[model samples]
Target chain A: MKKITVGFLALLFLMTLGGCKKKEKVKVIPPAEKQVAKTGEEVKEKPIPKPVVQEESIEDMSLEEINKKGYLQRIHFDFDKYNIREDQKPILIKNAEWLKAHPTVKILIEGHCDERGTEEYNLALGEKRAKAVRDFLISLGISPDRIKIVSYGKSRPLDPRHNEEAWAKNRRAEFVIIAK
Target chain B: MRKILIFMFLSLFSFSQQEITIRIKGGIPAIRIAVPPFIVRATTQQAISAAKEIEEAFRADLAFSRVFDPLSRDLIALVKDRNPEKPDLKAWESVGASVVFIGKVEEKGEYLRFVGKLYDARSKNFILGKSFYGKIKYRRLMAHRMGDELLKYFGQVPIFTTKIAFISDRDGNRELYIMDYDGMNQMRLTYTKGMEMLPAWSHNGEMIAYTSFRKGNPDLYIRHIYQGRDELVARGGSNITPDFSPDDKFLLYSSSLPGNYEIYIYNLRTKQRRRLTFSYGSDLTPKWSPDEEKILFSSDRSGSPQLYIMDSDGKNPRRITFQGSYNASPDWAPDGDRIIYVSRVLGRFNLYMLFLSTSQVIKLTSGMAMNENPCFSPDGRHIVFSSNRSGKYQIYIMDYDGKNLRQLTSKGNNLMPSWQKINYRR
Candidate 1:
C-alpha cells in the first residue's frame, strides 16, 4: 500500500512536469549548448540532484491516532443542498488542518436530514450531503481514501421532536473519528 | 422461491387453523359477541356514570370494530345495575351472547378509575383484562384504550390509539385535520386558512407530508404534527398523494409537472428530482410498496381510474388491477402481497383488494355508502377507511379480508385516514 501510494504520488508529480520537460530538452539540444552544459554537468556531477518537496500524502496518516488526539469536526450544509459552498471552505480547512497536523488519522461523516420528506428522499439526500463533504475534503489535498462517509437520512435524528428548532438541529452532517 | 414460499405459506396456513368447538360458520351473519355492561364496584353517584360511560365507549368501539356483535344493552339494562361481583353469568348466556364483558369502577379524588374483562361465553375464559385511571375529561381516552385492548384480544390491531389526517370543512374551509383513528381526538394539524389534503405520515411518526392549496395551487408541504411547524417541500402543479418510503429516505408522489399527473421521486439527500412517469393521462395517488420495490398508484393513463404498479425506479410498469370501472388510492399491505384501494364495482366506491401473485380480486366492501382512502395498519391485518354509511362521512376499520366492518366515528364528516405505524417504543 505504501509503495503504491508513493508510486501514485510520484506519477502525479511527474505528470505535472511531463509537458514542460519536453520543450526544455528540445531547447537545450543546441548541440553546441549541450556540449557546454555537458562540461558544466561533469563539473557538478557529484550526482544529478533530485528536486525534493515536503509533500505529505494522506495515506501515511492513521485516522485512529488523529481521533485519539481529538481533531474531528462535522461539516454542515444547507437544506436539501449537497454542494459544498465557499463559505463552508474554512470549516473544511480547519478539518484539513487537524488531519494534516495529526497524521495517521481517518474520519467518517454521517449525513442526516430534517424530517421534511419521505425516508428514501432523506437517505438519498443524506448520501449527497456526506458525499459533498468528502469531495470537498479531497479537493483540499486530503486523500479520498482517508475519509469514509455514510448516510443515516432522517432516521438517526439528533432531536426527536416536531418543532422548528428540532428539525433544524436534525438536518446536519456529523463527523466521527473512525481511525487514528 | 417456490420452496421458500411454500414453507412460509404453510406456516401462515397452520396458524389460521385454530380448533373451534362451536362452529362460527353460520347464524344471523353478525359476529356473535357480548359486551355486558360493567357493574360498578364503587358505591358513589359518579361511579354509576363512570362505569356506564366506559361501557358505552367500548360498545361504540366494539360495535364499530365489526369484529363483535355486542350483546343488547337493553337486556342488560333490564337486569338492574348492581355491584361488580354480583353478575349472573347465566343471564348473559340466555341472551345468546357468545362473549361477554364485565367491569368495576372507583373514585380516586376527582379522577375515575375502572378495570374490566372480556369473557368468551362458550369457553368461559377471560380474553382480556383492562384497567384505567384518569380524569373525567379522559374517560373517552380510557374508553378508546379499552376498545383498543378489545381489538387486540380478538387478534385485531388497536386502532383507537392510532389517528387520521384528512381534509375537512368543519372550520368553513378545507384544512388539515388530525383525529383519532376512530375519528375522535380531533385536532387541526394545519390551520393556515388554506386547503390541505392527502396527508401522508412519515414512518418515523414525527412529520406529515400533505398537499396545501395556500398558494392557490396544490403544493407539497412537510409539517411537524406537534409544533405545527411546516416547510414547503415541493411546488408546481397539482401535487398530491405523497407517500414515504419504508426507510423514510425518499418521497413517491404525484405531480402534474410534465403536463399531466405522473409519479416522481424527490431525493432529500441530493435535492435531485426525477420524474417517474410521462404517460398521456393523469397518474396520481402513488403508494409505496412495503418493500419499496414498486409503487402502486391510480392513473387515468389507461382511460378511467385504474391501479398500476411500476418498479421503484419507475421501470417495468404494468397494471395490477382490471376489475372495477374506477379504482384509486391503493395502499400496499405491509407484507407487500395484496393492495387495498377504493373501487367502484356496482356504483358505490368501496375498498377492494388485488392479489399480485394469483391475480385474485377480493371486493372487501359492497353496498351502502362510498368508501375511499384505505390505509393499512402497520401489521397489515386491518385497514382504516372513510365512508358515509352512517349518514355522515365517518371513519371505519375492517380486517384486510373484509370480514369485520365496524364504524369508528359517528360525530362529523371525517375522511381520508392515515394509519401510523405500530408504537415501537411500547
Candidate 2:
C-alpha cells in the first residue's frame, strides 16, 4: 500500500512537471529571439521545478483516523430550511478547501434535522440540506463524484434536548471521510 | 390492478352503507352490553389459563370497539347464570344491559374450542353466534375473531383482527414491529441493525414495504412477511416514505435520484417506476386515493411544505392546503372524503383532519407535544399515530373524533404506525 501511494505521487509529480515544461517551451518559441538565445537541446531538456504544497502525511492514515482529525466542519441550517445559513458558508468553504487539498479522499455528507418536522418530510428536508451543502462544495471546485450524501432525517440527533438551542445544533450536515 | 380495485370499491361501498345505518341507529348512547366470565370446561392447567386469556382478550376487544358500552363488573356479578344456553333473559334485562354476551370454552386435547353467543335481552332473541377452534397458543386470535363476529352482526366494520405495523427502537435500533390492534402479541419483523422507518402495509396484510438504511442508503424494501422473503425495490438515492397502492400492485414513494425529492410510483409486478411529480421542491409521502385515481402527497414547491393532489398518472396537480405554511404527511381516509395530516404551527407539530367536500379543517389533537404520522384504521373509525407527549415517542390510538386516547407502546421510542386490515377469509 505504501509503495503504491509513493509511486502514485511520483506519477502525479511527473505529470505536473510535463504540464509546466510544455507551457514554457510554447511561450519561449513564440518569442523567436528567446528561442534562438537557447539551444534546441537546452529548451527540450529544461526541467521545471514542482511547486510544494504544505500537507501533513496522511497517506498512511486509515479512513477512521483521517476522519478523527475533523478536517471538515459540519454546517448548520435554519429551521425547516435547507439553504446554508450565511454564517455557515465559511465552514463549507473551509471544508471545500480541505477536500480540495486531499484529492484522493471521498466523503459522505449526512443531513440531519431537528424533531420539529414530520418523519417523511424531515427526511426530504435533510436530503435537501445535504444537497445544498454538496452543491456549495462543488461550486468551490470540489468534484461532485467525491461527495456522497445521505439524510438521517430526524433519527440521529446531535442534541437529544427539545429546545431551540438543541434544535439549531441538530439541524446540520455532518461530514464523514469514507475513503482516504 | 383495475379489476382488484373495482372489487374493493364495490365491497367498500357496501361496507360504508352499513356503517351509515349503524351509526344512525347506535349514534346516541352506545349499545349497553354485558360480558360475564366464560364457563371453562377444561381439566388441565394450560387449557384453563388459555381459556382465561381468551375471555379477557375478548372482553377487552369489545370495550375498545367503543360501539359497545360494557356493563360494570358489579352489574355482571348480579347474575348467577353462567351457561351460554338457557340464560335468564329477565335477569339480564333487569341489569339494564340491552345485549349480553355468553361464552364457553372447552379443551379438546391440544386444541381449544370457543363458543360465543350474543343475544338481545329486551326481545330475548339471539343476535349472533360463533364457534372458533384453534391451538391453545392462539387464544388472543380466537378472541379477536369472536369480537369481529359481534361487530359484523352490528353492521360495523370488523377491526378487532386488524394489525398495526410500526417502528420501534427497543432492541437498540429502529426496526419494524407489528401487533394486534389492542396492543397484544407484539412481534418484531426486521433485524436490519440499521434504522427502519415509514412502514406501509399492503391491503392484503401479507406484505409490508418500508425504507431501511441497511445497505448504507435509505432504500425501499418489501418484506413478504408470511413467506419469509424480501425484495429490494428502490435504491440509487434516498428513498423513503413508502405507501402501498390500494390494489397493492404499486408503491407510491419519493426519491431524490433526480437531485430533488419527487413522488414516484413503482410497479410491483413489472418492476418499473414512473415519476409522478416534476417539482423543483421536495415531494414526499405520496398516498393513493381509495379509488386509486387520485394521489395525495406533500410538496414544498410553494416555498414551504404543503399537501397537494394529482391524478395517479401524474397530471393536473393542484394544491389542496393553503391554510398552513408547513403541512405534510397526509393520509386519505377509506371513505375518500376525509384526510388527516400534520401541520407545523409555531414550531409545534399537530395532527389535523381535512374535509375535502366542505374544505373545512378540524384539529384532532391539541398540546405542545409533537403528534405526527396519523393514519386511519382500515375501518375509517379510528386513527393510530405516534406522539412524544410522554417524553419519548410512543404509539397511540384514538377515535375518529379524537377521543378515548390510549397509548399502545411503552418500550423505548416507537413511531410511524401503519394500521392494516386482514381478510380472515384469505
Candidate 3:
C-alpha cells in the first residue's frame, strides 16, 4: 500500500510541473508569432539570449548615458527632403546593428526640422524623416515593434542660429532608447 | 391748421439734412475733430489723474479709427484752459476742427461718473452726450465704451472693445496672451512650460483653441476663457493651426496621423472628426470663410508652398495664388471678399491682400521687417499681424489698407495675432 501511494504522489507532482510549463509557453509564443506576422517571415526563431558583454555594458547605463555615448548616431537630411541620403545610410546601418544586438531594447526616433518652413508643414516633414529612418531599421531585421516615431517640427532646433550650416544641423533624426 | 403743417414740414427737412451730413462725413474724407483736456469735479489727486487718463484714451481711440483726424497735441494744449462742458467753439474752429470732444469726471462714492459730449464746432451744438459710471480701476474700459459710442454716432464700426489673442514668449516660454485692441490690459491665458501657438478665437469670443506642447507632443487644446478649463481635442501627432468655424459648430485644423499632414474638421457637439484634405503633401493653416462655404489653406502639392482654396466639404480644390513660390498663412477677410497671406519676395516675407473678385494682389507691407500671420479684425476694417521689425517679433495692428500702423506688443517674440469678435450684450 505504501509503495502505491509513493508512486501516485510522484506522478501528481510531474503533472503539476508540466501544467506550469505549458502556461509559460502560451504566454511567450504569441509575441513571437505577432512579430513574425508583422515582418511576414516564415522562420520560427526564438529571441537570442542577450550576449554577456553587451548586456553588461548596457545593464548599468541609463538611457541618457547610452545616447550620450553615441551608440546611435543622428542622421541628417537635405532641405525639405525626407529621403535617406547615401552618406546617411551607413549611420542608419550602424544604428540598426546596435538595435539588433539588443533585442530586449525599444527606441524612439525623433524627427526635427529647421525654422525655415511653417510650423505645421515642418511637423509633417519631420514625421516623414523619422519614418524613413524607422523603415530602414525595420528592413535591417530590427522588429518594427521596437521603434516609435515622434516629430518636433521646427519648435526644437539643435542650433538656434539662422544660417545654412545651422539649418543643416537642425534637420536631423535622433534615436533615443526608451527601454532595455 | 396751416401753422401746424408748416411746423411738421420744417422738422422733416431738418431731420433729412442731419442724416445727409452724417452719411457724407462717414463715406467721404475723414472728419476733423479737436480733443481738449478733461475737467475733474473731484478734489482728490487720483480722480484728477483718472480724468486725464480717460481723456488720453478717448483721443487715442479716435485717432486709431482713421475716420477722425484729431487735432495735434500742440493745438490741444492751446485749448487746455477752456471749460470742457462749455468748450470755446471759436478756439476749436480756429484749429480747423469740425467737431470737438468734451469730457468731465466726478467721484461718486466708490464709483466714478463720466459725462462726455461731442459738439459741432461750426454750429456750436451738441451732437451727442452720454454718461457712464464705473470703478476707478476700470477707467480704461469706461473710456473704451465712450469711444465705441462716438464711433457709432459717426457711422463707423466700433473696435475699441475687441481683444487680440497672440502668442508671446515673455515668460520664458511661448504662451497665449490677450490684450485690448489698443494694446492695454495685457493678460496671459496659458501658463504651460511648453510652447503654445496659433491661438484662434471662437465666433462668440468665449473660447480659444491653440496648439500646445505641454504633453511632450504638439496637441490641440480648446480652452474656455472665462471658466479657466481646457480639454485636449487631439493628441498623438502634430495638430496645429486651429480655427473655429463661423457657426462655432466645428474646428478646422491640420493633423499628421497615419501619414502626412491633412486638414481635419472636428465637430464640437458630436465629437467626431472628418478628414478634409488627402493630398500627398502637407495642407496646413486652414481658415474657414466667414460664410462657411469655403476653406483657404496653404499646400505644397505643387513642389512649393502656395495658397489653395476648397469648398467646405473638401471638394473642388482650386489654387488661388500663383505669383510667388512660397505663399502661405492665408486668412480670409471677415467680409469674405479678400484673402490675406504672406509671400516671400526677395527672400523676405511680407503681407499681401488678394481681392478674390478680381484676382488683384496688393502688397500691404513694405521695408518694415518680416511680417506674417495677418488676421482681420471683426469688422474687416483692420488687420493685426506680427513683425520682427523691432529687432524681435512683436504684434502690430494696421488699417485694412495697411495704414495706421501701430505696435501692440514689445516684449519677447510675439506672433500669430488673432482678433476676437465684438462681444455685444444681448
Candidate 4:
C-alpha cells in the first residue's frame, strides 16, 4: 500500500515536471508569433523556429562535449568484485536521477578491471561489474534501452601504476554519453 | 665426375633403421648430441651468412626442446668433421656425444638446400638423413624443419616449427603478433589499429581466433594468417576470448549479448551459434578438450571465478577448483591428464597445475608478481605464460616441471600467449 502511494506521488511529480516543460514551450511561441506578424500579413506561420528553440532547450551538444558535462557518475568496484558497495549507492542514485531527467540521452557504461587477473577472466569480471551497475539503474527505473555496457577488461586503465590506489580507480564502470 | 655421383648416391642410401627406440620419458636421461657448425658451400655473402644463422637457430631449437642434451661448444670444438658426408664418429664419441649431427648448407641460385645427417657415434651408423629445400629468406624455417625431423625420429611431436600467438602493446596498441617458439622473428599479424587480445591459434595453425575492438566494441575475429584475410566471427555486446575447436570448424567464446556473459559455441562453416551456459554469472575462457568431447572453462557462477568442466554440448557442468577462491584461465594440456590454470592467493597470481586423475594440485610458480594465461606447448612439455616479475609484463616459457624457465619476449607488455596446437598420432 505504501509502495503504491510512493509510486503515485512519483508519477504526479513527473507530470508536474512535464507541465513545466509545456509552459516553457508556450512561452517561446509568443516571440515566434511576433516574428510572423512582423514578416508578412498573408504568410503562413511555419512554426519551424519555435520547435528549434524548444529543441535547443536540451542543448545541441556533441557526444564528447556532452560527456564532458559529467552528469552521470562513474562507479568503482572493490578488487575482484562486482557487487555495488553500500557507500557507492548514493553516487548511483544521483546518476540514475540524472539519467531520468535526460530520458533521450543514451549512455555506454564501460566496465574496467585492475591488471591482476588474466585478460579473459578480467573481461568477464568487467562485464559483471557493468551489469551490476545496469541492474542497479534498472531498479531505480532507468530504461534498459538508454544504457549499453562494454567490458574493457584491463586494457584501458585510468591509472597505469601498479598499486592499490590505482587499482581502485581502474576497477570502475565509466559512463560515456553515446547519443543525445 | 662419375665417382662423385656414385658417392653421393651411396651416401643418400646409407640411412639405417635403428632397432632401439628413444623415448623421452621421465626417468630416461636426455640423449647427448653433438651439432658441428654447418658446412657452408655458398659463393654469395647472403647465403654464407644464412648458413651460419641456420646452424645457430637449429642448435637453439635443440636446446629449447629440453629433450636433447646438446653438446657444449667446447666439446664440439674437440672434433672437426670437415666433410659432413664422412663424419669421424669415433672422435665425436670421445667428446661424450652419443649422437652426432653433420649438416651441410648449399646455396643453389635463389634457394638453399640443407642436408642433415644423424649418426650413432658408438656404432658409426647413419641413423637418418634429411634434406630441407627452401628460399634463403626461410633459413630459420628450414633450420626448424631439421629440428622437427630429429624430434619425429625420436617419437615426439615436432614443436620447433610451431608459433606462439600473443598480444603485444609495443606498437602503441595491443595487436596480434606471432613469434617463433624461441621468440625470434616477432612479426605483427594485425593492423586493425584497435586493441586485440586473447588470441587462440587453431590446431591446424592456419587461423587465429581473437577478440578485437576495431568496431568500437570487442568483437571476435578469425584471421586466416597465411591467406591475409579476416572473418568477423561475432559482434554486438562485447565478444571476446575465442577458442578454436580441435578441427578448426567451430569457435567457443563468451559474449554479453544475452544480458550477461555466457559461453557460446559457433559453427565456423554454418555461422550458427548456440548458448552453452545460462547463468547470471560470467562464463569465460572456454577451451575444447583434446578429443572435443568436453570443454574446460572458467565461471563465476559459484560467487567467484573457478574452473569448470562440462560436456561439449553444455551438459553436466561441474566446478574443479576448490582450493583458491580466484581460479581462472584453465587450459587443458594435450596429454589430457593435467590442467594448467592461474590461481590468486592473497592478491598474488600464480600458475597451478592440477592433475585430473589424482586431484593433486601443484604450484608451478611462486613470486609476488602476476603469472597468468598459461598455455601448454603442442607437445605438452612446456608452458608459455605472461608475467610482470621484471616490472613489465613479458612472455616467458617454462618446463612442465617448473624448471628451466626462459623469457621469450622482452618488449612492451606481451600477454595472453596461445601456443599453436599440433595433433600427434599415438
Global fold similarity of model 2 (TM-score): 0.85
Candidate DockQ values, in order, are: 0.01, 0.54, 0.37, 0.49
Best-fitting candidate, scored by DockQ: 2
Question: What would the per-residue lDDT of candidate 4 be over residues A22-71, giving only the tens digit for each residue?
Answer: 99998865775676678766655365542434343345677777778788
Model 1, residue B384: displacement in angstroms? 5.4
What lDDT does the true structure give each of the candidates?
Answer: 0.69, 0.87, 0.83, 0.87
> Which of the CAPRI classes, incorrect, acceptable, medium or high, describes model 4?
acceptable
Q: Residues B126-159, candidate 2, lDDT per residue (tens digit)?
A: 8888999999999899999999888887766689
**DockQ score for candidate 4:** 0.49
Error of 4 at A71 (Å): 3.2
iRMSD (1 decimal) for each model: 12.6, 1.0, 1.8, 1.5
Superposed Cα deviation of residue B163, candidate 2 (Å): 1.2
- Clashing residue pairs, backbone N/CA/C < 3 A, model 2: none
Better of 1 and 3 by TM-score: 3
Return the lDDT, model 1, position A115.
Answer: 54
TM-score of each: 0.55, 0.85, 0.81, 0.83
Candidate 1 chain A, run of 10 with poorest lDDT: A115-124
DockQ of 3: 0.37
**RMSD score of candidate 4 (Å):** 15.2
- List runs of model 4 lying over 4 Å from the truth: A1-60, B1-29, B80-82
RMSD of each: 22.4, 13.6, 14.3, 15.2
Report the Cα lDDT for residue B21, model 2. Answer: 31
